[model samples]
Target: MASTLTRLGAGILSKFGRSVASPTRLQSRPYYLYSPEPFHPIPDKQPLCMTADEAVTVVTSGMRIFVHGCAATPIPLLDALARYGKEAKLHNVELIHIHTEGPGILAQPEYDGIFRCNNLFIGANCREAVNAGRADFTPIFLSEIPNLFRRKIWQLDIALIQVSPPDNHGFCTLGPSVDCTRAAIQNAKYIIALVNPNMPRTFGDGVIHMSHCDVVVTGTDPLPVISQHCCSEEEEQIGRLISENLVQDGATLQMGIGSIPDAVLSKLYGHRDLGVHSEMFSDGIIDLVNKGAITNAKKTIQTGKIVSSFAFGSKKLYNFMNNNPSVVFNDVAFVNNTAVICQNPKVTALNSCIEIDLTGQVISDSIGTKMYSGVGGQVDFIRGAALGLDGLGKPILAMQSQTHKGSSKIVPFLKQGGGVVTTRAHVHYLVTEYGIAYMFGKNLRQRAYELIKIAHPKHRECLEKAAFDRLKVMPCP
Candidate 1:
């Protein structure tokens, strides 16, 4: 088992080396067939109810297991799995998922041979393991992750998920997360579910019958709580600029997590009939919903409903979505589809970046050689909003002018290994606290000059010098 893991890890490291060397040549490879799956689930069979420790006994060495992510991350099952694997002397049991939370013991160096993580989208919990070369990172768009399962690109042996308890007629829902779970369950040979009463009974593509479950473990874990973001002064300024200049009263919105997004949402209370169609949303939207700003009435698609793939936020946010027909959690394959997102009017996609080069190349996934987060839905919404139906769509990239360490985020060139998640060709608007830089249809010099104007005042002169050196043209009025 150890030898098999070494062979697989070497293959991934070699591929990762090439990806770092020539990013264009890097191709994504999900978990390969470690070994043959011996067990096949029977049809129309009732699930065997068991404790967490007993339910996890079905997992074995050399099998790829998909762990549920986000607010619905199964704590009890994972803790039990950790204990069981250590006690049973397990090895080479690979775990795959997107940005799950909790004190991720399984991905640490201590669990090297016992448990390994294959991350589709890296998160804070797994960031250290990924950077230390303990876990593997796959850079794929959220829109396409479903195909890995639905098309059998990645063979799954088991899917570990958490869900709301069974309703009358024995129906259970995937709750807050429905992004890729549907596809995972359809392809997995067996399913193990944790029935948590705290999981919100959401509406959309997350429905499953109890008969589909191979093993069921009951839990009463509370959803992980994220406190509401208090926007900084710079973030507030960016929010105001976007709200006043870019977002229309009836615009359909797409925003990612963090303080800037929350700030933008804070400023939108006056906007009317605004709709949300994002890959994921946080607690920011709850206030807008309360203030009658997010009526979802004017959206061209999914009228009168807020369409999202998954949600992560405070308990207040979850409570608002509980059994609420207005908030729909669908699969990302459909929700983040460019065609689907473009159908709406004034599609305003608000995204952030780690840094952006003078030529408008935006890097969000990594800093230099380290992978911080994954390219989840930045391109999905950026391209979607760029092709918006009414031509009023705005794809705005907002970030602070300078980092906390006083380094310029708008640079002459991207750091050597930064992943260009949004290309210069796709960039429309770049915002800083100073002002907005409209990059669409701009010449190289013009783009640099505009970006420099909004850069931190202290760095503008150096940026000008650097721009002249790189572009070989004086950015003059």
Candidate 2:
């Protein structure tokens, strides 16, 4: 296995070299027997539109398939695949993707043997299947997902995608989610697209000529929209602390979706020349962009563009991204690359965690033995921001002091079976409603004291006692 992986790595490096030399290059050798011609917009040739059933007929048993994920999941294509699996009794079909939103019919218990999901990031839709041993999850960084397909580590037979209709030039956009779908489309043996009029015609590397798609099915279903909740007073307070204490003017930002990130963006109205280069962003950024707060003027990379791999938000957010030249959607590998991210000046990476120990270990993916979320791009952005040019970047982990049930999120040690997504060496700034805890360059005892200081007042005493009992360090009264 080691030797095989080594060979694959070498082959990828060779291809990478060739690709850098020639941007319009194609693979010299095909993974499958059928190889489509180079993509070019055919001005006069009309597309052969078909029904969902007709498109699904091309799928055969034992073929590896790629499903577009997130809000852009191809529902029509997925439903067709499920129906086909049931009607044809297909077996050994592998479905690969990241966190997808929706029912995920292929992952249903009835299709256990017909379709097996290999997920990079597990979502609520497939969590039950994974836990029940009907599906499998591969713990990996979002930054490296595109590499798996681009490098041919996993040769895909079919690519199922949801895209906007072709324009005058016969080019269609991959819409809101582009993370690894671009790579999948480029590498897959056959491309099956669910062309939807509702999918936003987003700009950037997401645009592809219609000639690349082998089968196209038109649908009118509304694209999924994820709404953001109003941040609580405590969350707002934490956001203020982070914005005032850590975020600087002209800083580049990397943040994820949620209430905390929303609160932080709300507080950044006064900041100047702010830039966004996150793995994923939500509706909070739209207001900032409209107010000229996020000018993207001072970023070292993509200086005047909002760079992101994927986006999730309301219908308004989707409409805002349509044909927007300022927003540049790229693949996850480039958007989340640590080296590429640190090129920007004063990169501030805002992330959240499930829980953290006094020693500064972060548990962001799993809760005890249960997989809550995947280790998406926390470490990628954290390390990138920490190593920012000339110490201007900052990695801030923000969360509430207590859970909804009033339990302290700060603990003496991580719960058993909870994996550490970020280690002590990587943790720098920890923020809560109370205050900020600067953990960089601090010893274990000092870290414990600092963390306990920012913990909820009701739990501070108990946390200090636990730290003393575990680390044999006296608490500072």
Candidate 3:
């Protein structure tokens, strides 16, 4: 201990005060002990700043670049890249990111081979491009994305990120996004950051020193904001079924963004001490915090803090995260780890799917052969909750009984080429506006009966007939 402290730089020793520093893990918190308090390390030198156009000048053809994603997307840099690419006639400049929000021109026909996008998870901005074959999507678990960069599988030449201004000690936070961007910086040859004062300074594994940036672009662009989703009557009914029946007090939650998620969270105000350990979150959680429903007191890990990899929401939600100690943003790799997720009690992973077959096969990422979205972190949290520490976890899949076109979502067979994001074995609880179905340990015939019970009333007869044909036994409900 004496030798380790002797090796410590005077700056860290002085700033850290009485906090013990372990040599094995030289961070704000020791390996054995961790708190949600924000920490900053002093830097010996500050990095120089440059204009957005000048920063992209380092890009050469055939270089793969990683763009920061979610609400933390660097809008100005991306816009500048598009302009500079056309001007310089740059070709084969591959861009990688997950669910970014900005000018969607990179994948347009005009840019074409100049700037090609490879989305780890498709968002609205690039969905059309991916489907059109102008852009590409990689279907992988969100938890393993970091390995793609770190292990040099998808070697990155440059990393573009958005961050808050450097603190007094010259440390800037990665703002709302940490996930794979952190790993990108760790391995990328060049690191470019857009310093946006409007980006919220969040805590957890996102802090970086300005000295680490190869080039910095200063901008004050406001982060993109998504308004709250209003739930439909059917969505509201689905929410009530999950919230009232499955969501218990002291449960840890993992959910995505949508009317179904919004509906579920809307009804969680009556619960007590509910915890959040999700890959990402949106404005829906803000109300639960306001209503005193999400106190995080009952969580066995990271007690008293809402844990997430990133967030995307309205200005109100961003304000709630700025320098807020109660919220701890972490790396998506750790946040979605089944081992970490199952450490908590009653982890309810509330999710939605595009469709489900009678035998419990789920299709979420595609409509038949055409890709609609990338496979996100659904399987991670689903398996995590299925193995919850206290033995009462719920892995639930919820959706409306019928598609927007009035077709039954519960079918006897998945679409001819539909991608199954979650398989039959991983499934446990399935919810719909009509009711809930528990599928764990059930045979094919039994699972079909439960699913038909919760399917739309108009489609039940057809589903029943289809089930008997498939199961070779009468599926009576």
TM match of model 1 to true structure: 0.91
lDDT of 3 by residue, 1-477 (tens): 112212322232234332221222222213112322223332343344567876777777788889999999998998889998989788999999998997677878899989999999988889888989999999999999999976779878788999887766567899888887888777676677898889999999999876666567778888999865578999999999999999999899998888999999989988999999999888889989999999999898799999999998888888999999999998889999999999998999998999999989999898988788778899999999998888989999999999899999999999998999999999999999999999999989899999999999999999999988888998754
Q: lDDT at 266 for candidate 3?
A: 89
Q: Candidate 1 on 293-405: residue-level lDDT in tens? A: 99999998889999999999888888989999999999889999999999998999999999998889999999999999999999999999999888999998999999999
Against the correct fold, how does model 3 do in TM-score? 0.91
lDDT of each: 0.85, 0.84, 0.84
Off by over 4 Å in 1: 1-44
> Of the candidates shown, which would achieve the greatest lDDT relative to the real structure?
1
Which residue pairs of candidate 3 clash?
none
Q: Model 2: which ten-residue window has the lowest total lDDT? A: 1-10
**Residue 402's C-alpha lDDT in candidate 1?**
94
Worst 10 residues of 3 by lDDT: 20-29
Root-mean-square deviation (CA) per prediction: 10.0, 9.0, 8.2
TM-score each candidate: 0.91, 0.90, 0.91
The segments of candidate 3 whose C-alpha lies over 4 angstroms from its true place after superposition are 1-45
Enumerate clash totals for all models, in the order shown.
Answer: 0, 0, 0
